[model samples]
Target: MTDFISLRNISKCYSAAGRSVFALKDLSLDIRENEFLAVVGRSGSGKTTLLRILASLEEPTAGEMRFRGKLCSPGNPLPSGMVFQDARLMPWLSALENIIFAFPPRERTAELHEAAKKMLETVGLSGCERSMPRELSGGMAQRVALGRALIKNPSVILLDEPLGALDYFTRRAMQRELIRIYLQEKKSFIMVTHDVGEALRMGTRVIVLGEGQMRKEINVDFSYPRPRSDPRFQRLIDEVLDAIGDGE
Candidate 1:
């Protein structure tokens, strides 16, 4: 099977205050089709930069990126949808409208509306569609953002700390919801997160970034609904943390 996403010796640098700073260093990775891959790392570890490169939101100073065997060039349209850390919704628009904003105005408007409604329901935000972003809770707004992404029906989804702002309970719930969506939709998911447990719970493979490089890759061979207290899970977390030089 062809790899859904491939990054070959990718590197990125930025000029700041007349000096060049490297954000990524010769990074290479492959994400298989229909796989849920989580990228975990400390602040400034290049996790977000990696996602941006994969999504074509940012350009790499060196190397190549491809999606589904096609070369990814600058300004190349992303084959995937994205959900950021913030909901990034149009505060002026209702939840439904924000979702519909991406759809082209054509004869299929009604069909798109129905599709958006179903996506909202899939994300467990059924009755709240008519509410504006200001009226909705943070979790609800994020759910709407997720719904918007899913409504695109892209082959891949890039999540940049999408659940980071939620409270513990909501975050846990969203983790389960993400897994369900991945299983039901069978779409490729690549997520950047700092939460180790979240990565372990939702990702079939976890890639650890550290010091501007891909440091480690781990596979969670265990089944879904993995227990945090499970000895193997805790052991894997410790190993990852240690790999990143985090003692705790």
Candidate 2:
């Protein structure tokens, strides 16, 4: 498979209190087309910063990124769409309208509406098109956000701790929903999550970020709908935790 996304020698730094804080240092990664990759890390480990750079939301202090073998430039419509930790939906807009917000307003208004509604349905929000963000539950709101991201039909999807705020059941349900979408859409997915188990369950490959760099990469190599109690899955979780220097 071809490389859909590539990052070479990427680094980011911010000056704080007359000192420099290194968020990422010399990180290099390649995401193959249609691959589902998860990045797991502790707070301040630079996972979010890496995703921001990939999404073109922030420029890296050093190194380069390429999309579809083309050099990525500033102001480029990133070959990807992003979902943040919060739903970030406009409170006044209905679910369908929020998804439509990303589309260009022209003769395609009706086409965009149809696409948005289809995406909402794909995310399992079929009948909630007219629902406002305030009227929806947290999981429902996040589903709307997912619909918004998918409606754009980007080649890659960047999820920045998007499932972090949900309760256990909702979070698990969303994880399965995300996996289902990944399989159905076959679009590359790069998610930054702190949940190790979720990472193990969802990612075909898991990358661990630690101490200002990517510390480990583990391939799950298991079939989909992975069971939580499987020995291999549990072992992978322990291994990822150990990579971050965490104890059992």
Candidate 3:
């Protein structure tokens, strides 16, 4: 359980209306190998900013990150894939094509199609390979997006509210799908979500953020398909809600 990725004194700032705005402040975290880490907070809590920094989509204003003991920055980021709330698939591409689109054109070998097909199966969408984005259900389209990320064979996967668009049952199903993929791929999965229960159910460890800093950390310390009715589970949820300043 070594550190796969480490952030040291990370910070992000911007100037708005002639005033400095800090999106993240002295936020430090260590992501371990094969662990599912969930980040929870209310709006403007810096959750998405943290994920963006990890993905190299945004550079931190201060501090640094290390991946596998090597320094990482926007120019030298961790080998990772990112999935957004929207599937963001090309409107004209089929499921198979969407997964293959992850690679650059020159890297799109005949072998890549087979790999994409395998990834589709991995995400539980084997027979829907030829289905167009418009033809797939919300969950199915999101699964294709997941396959697109997994096909890259990244060391870590960053999820930014990827299931927020789904209905209740679909969201639950996707949660299980995500866990299954996490175990099977053995890669670090870092997700940002507003749902406290969702974080408690899926994360091996949960980190709570408020006003750009971590307020609390909790360990699930149990097996998957977490029992929501268990008193321990309820208690942890309560603790997390309180940490987020929403407990009443």
Candidate 4:
């Protein structure tokens, strides 16, 4: 696999209450193309901080991040789009408009509408283009959010707990949707999810972090639509739980 993103000795620290708080410490990892990398860890493990640093939303206090052999900057950031836990859609915008808003306002045109419409279809929201955020269910709203990210045709997509808000059934359905999108789009997707089972179900490789450090990296060799009842699947979950020191 070709390396898409590489982080070398990445560290992030902040001063809070006269104490130096380190979210990440001397961390290094490589994300390859077309890989679904799930990041799992306990609270304060710096999972979200890692994602934000990669997204260029936060500046790392130390270390370097390179994308495809080039240094990354705010202007020449990683070739990716991001989705948050909440759909974060514009309240007044239609689903299609929400997708279109991902592009710059200066770049908005009739052509972008057709592009958004196509992405809406791609994300299984074919008939809901005109639906406002108020009219859409939680799952449907997230679908719109996913559309916004995918519409950018990014080489990588960063998701920070993108499905944590949905109902159990809706979350399961969206999990399948995520796998389907990953396979169809073949983009490098790094998702930071608290749900261990969700990570095992979706990721090609799972990275476990603890106390601001990488604790484990496990490769899920199982195919999509993996059976949790299978012994291998359950073992993987156990391994991840153990990594987070929450074996259960």
Candidate 5:
């Protein structure tokens, strides 16, 4: 199948005290439909930058990014949603309100309310409609964030260090939740994570980056609920580690 999204020689630069610093240089990627792509790299390796560029939160300083062969820009944003390490939920709003917040003021009608309510249920936070951000646990709050993003009915979902803040148990649970959501939603998911195990567990394809460049791309042919105990699984992890120089 053809690529759903393409980034051709994309580069991003930052000006620091009149000094040009490159966050990403000559990075290229092709994202397909219904894919779970995981990006792993050390800090300053531009994993987050890549995700931001895909989310339309940041622009590439050079080269081009296209969704379905059309240039991506503010006027023509990608059909996608983004989540971050922090849930960033509104303190004052309830769970349902937070989900509906994704829609424009003019479109947040009774119908959207029903849709938002359904979305809350979709993320497994049904009865938490009236729960405030402060009232919910870390996992529940993140669920609300996911709802906000998914309520847009986006074709792709970009996540940056999602589940990084949760406890180990919550993180594992959320991982399962993510898989369930992905299987049901059938949306492309691009996640930037520091956890190799997490990436192996969720990603259908894993890309390793170093010094703002693509170092390797590994295909994970295994099924969902990946067999971490399998020898092939360990081999892939070791290979990714080697590519990342994490073995050191």
Candidate 6:
């Protein structure tokens, strides 16, 4: 497939104490449509920085990004949805209202309410639309956040540790749910996670980053619901850990 989104020699730098900090250094990547691309690395390895740049939340200090074929910047960000570690739901809004909030005020009609209701069902929250964020469980709240992102129907979805705060069981369940959603929506998904195993399970392709540069790229050819005990899966984990300099 041709590149759906392309980043060419992208770099991001920050200034602290009159000194420069390089978050990403000359990184280039291509994302294809209908694929799950997982990014893995240690803290400060630029995984989140790259996702931010892709989301157009941050501008690259150098280089450029092209979506489809046109250049994109902070002023003209890509058409995409983003989910962070925290659900970041509005405490005052019900689950249904939170999703309706994705639309502009003028667009929030009765029809829109029906659409949001469908979205809640899509995220497996059909009966909980009346619940507040505080009332929902961590996974359910994150599902609401996912629903909010999906309601807009963007071509790409950017996930930054969206399941990081959930318990082990919930996290695993969310991982499966994410895989299901990615396949059902047939959209490009760029997810950044610290867990090598999670990356292996969820990504069609995994990119390992170190020191703000691409260390390795691994293609996961197996089907979804991959067995963790499989030798191939374990080997891929080892390879990614080695790429991240953690396999020693």
Ranking by lDDT: 6, 4, 3, 5, 2, 1
Q: What is the lDDT of candidate 5?
A: 0.91
Error of 5 at 172 (Å): 0.3
TM-score of each: 0.95, 0.96, 0.97, 0.97, 0.97, 0.97
Model 3 misplacement above 4 A:
none
Residues 177-237, candidate 3: write the lDDT tens digits: 9999998998889999999999999999999999899999998998987989988899999
Query: Could you tell me how far off, in angstroms, the CA of residue 4 lies in candidate 2 after the best superposition?
Result: 1.8
Q: Report the lDDT tens digits of candidate 2 across residue range 1-248.
A: 35577889999999999999999999998888887899999999999999999888889999998887888978664677788889999888999898887665753555677788899999999999899899999999988888888887889899999999999999989999999999999899999999999898999999999966989999989988899889999899889999988957
Q: Tens digit of lDDT per residue, candidate 5, span 1-248?
A: 35589999999999999899898999988998999999999999999999888887888899888898899997788988888899999898999999988887976677898999899999999899999999999999889999999998999999999899999999999999999999999999999998988998999999999988999999999898887898889999999999999775
Structure candidate 6, residue pairs in collision: none
Error of 2 at 9 (Å): 0.5
The lDDT for every candidate, in the order shown, is 0.87, 0.89, 0.92, 0.93, 0.91, 0.93
Root-mean-square deviation of Cα positions for candidate 3 versus the true structure, in angstroms? 1.2
lDDT of 6 by residue, 1-248 (tens): 36579999999999999999999999988899898999999999999999999888889999999999889976778999989999999999999999888887976676888999999999999999899999999999999999999999999999999999999999999999999999999999999999999999999999999999999999999998898989999999999999999996
Alpha carbon deviation, residue 107, candidate 4 (Å): 2.8
122, model 2: CA deviation in Å?
A: 0.6
Instruction: For residue 89, give model 5's deviation from the true position in Å.
Output: 0.6
lDDT of 4 by residue, 165-220 (tens): 98999999999999999999989999999999999999999999998899999999
Q: Candidate 1: global Cα-lDDT?
A: 0.87
Q: Is candidate 2 or candidate 4 better by TM-score?
A: 4
Model 5 residue 157 CA deviation in Å: 0.4
